[model samples]
Target: MADSQRTSEPINIVHQDEIWKAHVKLEKDSAEVWPRKWGFLTDIYKEYKMESVKMKETLKVGLPSHEVVPSLTTLQKHNHVGPSPPVPQTTQALIGWRSGHAHLQLEKYSTVHHGRRSFLKELGWPFDACY
Candidate 1:
């Protein structure tokens, strides 16, 4: 091939060493800044814990300790019902709605991961077209 059209050669050992050194320096700099960058998250977590404690105290005062929380079986007994009529139109409509919502969520995820389809497929997504 002509020199102008030739592909570039791989980096030499000296150049690779320099690149490694630069990467190490960059990593060290980032490590130094990482704590400062994420320090607010720690503060926020502390505030959240304090607020949760205050809420728990408020709840304890407002609600009776004898109140019985509903069991899952009780809730399921009240909520579970017989299967719906096997109406083709209604089934298709519900599937469409669910697929549309799933697609929208996948679009948002794709902006970050750029592998939403493969990720969903790996998770064994039921609706192939949604991803």
Candidate 2:
């Protein structure tokens, strides 16, 4: 019994020693890794702050100030000589040149796809037969 207890005590002590070593190794690794991660994050944050400041400075220098730019009423008075032309009430005028181009494209698509379907109709086939 004395010999058996002595053998079992050494095994338990070795197991406890292994668990203590693992705990210490984990603490040391955590201590080593976190500082490097925090340092890298700090550097990135500093760079971002510097870039933001540079962008703000560039914007401040590039954009015209309120005092330098002419107001809307001042521009209107200078541009118009006498009476202004009447504004058109049509939707085409409101949409401008893009509307004319869109209308022409629609007409072309209809002529190609819908207007030329008579051949398929005469042959007793579906309109999408070619497709």
Candidate 3:
């Protein structure tokens, strides 16, 4: 096993007059916080929307690399709550786009899955409403 040492300097218990001292160095640390004006799930959606606009502007200027897009290149390197290996902004935007697309797919699927429920409701089959 690797040797374990006390974080602070060693002190002699036998010396009644000696004082014990421990020093801790302070450093800036990165932290994640919620932003105002947008919901959690919706924030990614908004990012996706803005990124798309920037992407169009990049194309208009004939930029060589899509990576030149500020939104794509501005991914945070150290987000405490982000995924391991660090997700790129472009990848996150794609994920947001896909997620929105999936919701549409689900709504489409509801026509099939909820057909019976809708039919029953149309026939006056009263149901308790709850969130």
Best by lDDT: 2
Q: Rate the local accuracy (lDDT) of all candidates.
A: 0.71, 0.73, 0.51
Ranking by TM-score: 1, 2, 3
Q: What tens digits encode model 2's per-residue C-alpha lDDT throughout 1-131?
A: 77766854446778889999999999999989997777788888999999999999888765467658888999998764443344568866765434345433435445554455488899999889997
Structure candidate 1, residue pairs in collision: none
Comparing 1 with 3 on TM-score, the higher-scoring candidate is 1
In the range 1-131, model 3's lDDT, one tens digit per residue, is: 22245646665575634332221111111112223423566778989999999989887766568656556335554322322343447865656454354343435445554334465477676566423
Question: Model 3 reaches what TM-score against the true structure?
Answer: 0.17
> Which regions of candidate 1 deviate over 4 angstroms?
1-11, 61-131
Off by over 4 Å in 2: 1-32, 61-124, 127-131
- Checking candidate 3 for backbone clashes, the offending pairs are none
The C-alpha RMSD of each candidate to the native structure, in angstroms, is 20.2, 18.7, 25.6
TM-score of structure candidate 1: 0.36
Candidate 3 deviant stretches above 4 angstroms? 1-38, 61-131
